[model samples]
Target: HISALKKGRFWITPDPYHKDDNIQIGREVKISCQVEAIPSEELTFSWFKNGRPLRSSERMVITQTDPDVSPGTTNLDIIDLKFTDFGTYTCVASLKGGGISDISIDVNISSSTVPPNLTVPQEKSPLVTREGDTIELQCQVTGKPKPIILWSRADKEVAMPDGAMQTESYDGILRIVNVSREMTGTYRCQTSQYNGFNVKPRDALVQLIVQYPPAVEPTFLEIRQGQGRSITMSCRVLRAYPTRVLTYEWRLGGKLLRTGQFDVQDSTEYTVSSLSRDSYGVYNCNIINEAGAGRCSFLVT
Candidate 1:
């Protein structure tokens, strides 16, 4: 209360409680305001809790009982004390001619109720996407005092493919732009802080899966000046979900190359030594993976 309130001078104080003043969690608490001012008819009352206006509902009721009383009066009844209900309550009385008076009181609740029941409704949804696609993983948390949500990803893979980026919103929303094959991993959303309360800290997880096609452009080993030296060529894919299981085949023109004319290296590379006139045509590499197959060709002279 400020001294300037003396002009209209309506003091606001918590009246005696029906029970004890010590309010417990999950229990109802009632407080009455005794207002003393110059004129009772012009006095208008409004209530606030923690700087926010308080409204009447099933959980709370605020109204004037008697208008003829010398000092205006307003009653506040809280049905149940939630964790968020433990805050300062204020009552302000204003007169028609710009005169104002206000007072605030604290409502302390017991910490033994429940430790914020937090849950994510959409945690079971799959966050799967194809390569070069936009992806969003949504998580909704419900709790009293509103739990703070934060998102984190496991370091298993990093998809900087073509400058892809990711972002998380205040409401536990994760967005990835230009999703790529290397972005697959596990992501989690959990609560951070809740004042000094002993919260149980809840969390949810989602699996991210990225799928892509095989690389269509394979590097070729440049053929040096003619010789009996061997020339090596490769057909490979940089990214695949089950990456190690790729199949590669080397073809000359439209027909498969003979094993005696070229040597196969792992699953992607092929070498053609002892240059014969038959190797002077176009050489094609066919690479196959779980997602799809791709091919690239190079003219050997």
Candidate 2:
């Protein structure tokens, strides 16, 4: 009787094992456990986490094998391994003869994908202006890792002077100091990122044309009486780029006078005819060019 009891009884009741030793986060893995017992007609299985009983609603599933042939094989599936599931797992089995067994398994999860992408946006080219005039140059870029931007002039990099350059990280804006003629040249914007394996390089070129205001203000501001009873005012603009457009206006007592004798010529010369005492208080010539506007005023007696 003692020999038969020993041969029919199984010592180990549960054996647990993990599908893989290492797994990445956000992936699926399986955990299996087996139990061997005599007279498996009344056998119960339970799973636990870190020595604590696990609930069925804890995203864990258990399946029982054939009870008549191999009642010891039970499988537990844990889908979608997460960082929080990196602890130990245990399986418990119970039989009718007060037989019980438990087994433990461990799981580890990690990351296995590359980083995010980085992008840079198009920037507006710098504008050209004359010396002593306020000039602003701006560049904008965008990226996931937040790319670093640099500004250069004439192939030489420029640094922010004392309270000269201002930067807005949220808006990705870069501003330069007061611009001068020496500051005019080919400006380039370079962007780079160190988070990726290869450094991403992007650049944009802008040409700055420094133009001076209409040089040599128009001269020859004179009023003369003609042979007939007509007054003529002649003005000439000397050495003006873009062939400045000239305009002549006559004022009396600080009030503009209406005259049908106003003339404007593209030959850098302006003349007005049929002028009388009413159009002889003050005469002024206005010269304009792409750079800026200039004026010359003279009093007529």
All candidates: CA RMSD in angstroms? 13.3, 23.5
Which candidate achieves the best TM-score against the true structure?
Answer: 1
Model 1, span 30-69: residue lDDT tens? 5555445555566667778877898888888887866656
Please write out the lDDT profile of model 2 over residues 153-208, one tens digit for every residue: 54455543333332322233444455555565776555532221123356566566
Total backbone collisions, model 1: 0
> Which is the leading candidate under lDDT?
1
lDDT of all predictions: 0.58, 0.47
Error of 1 at 161 (Å): 12
- Write down the TM-score of every candidate: 0.46, 0.37
- Model 1, residue pairs in steric clash: none
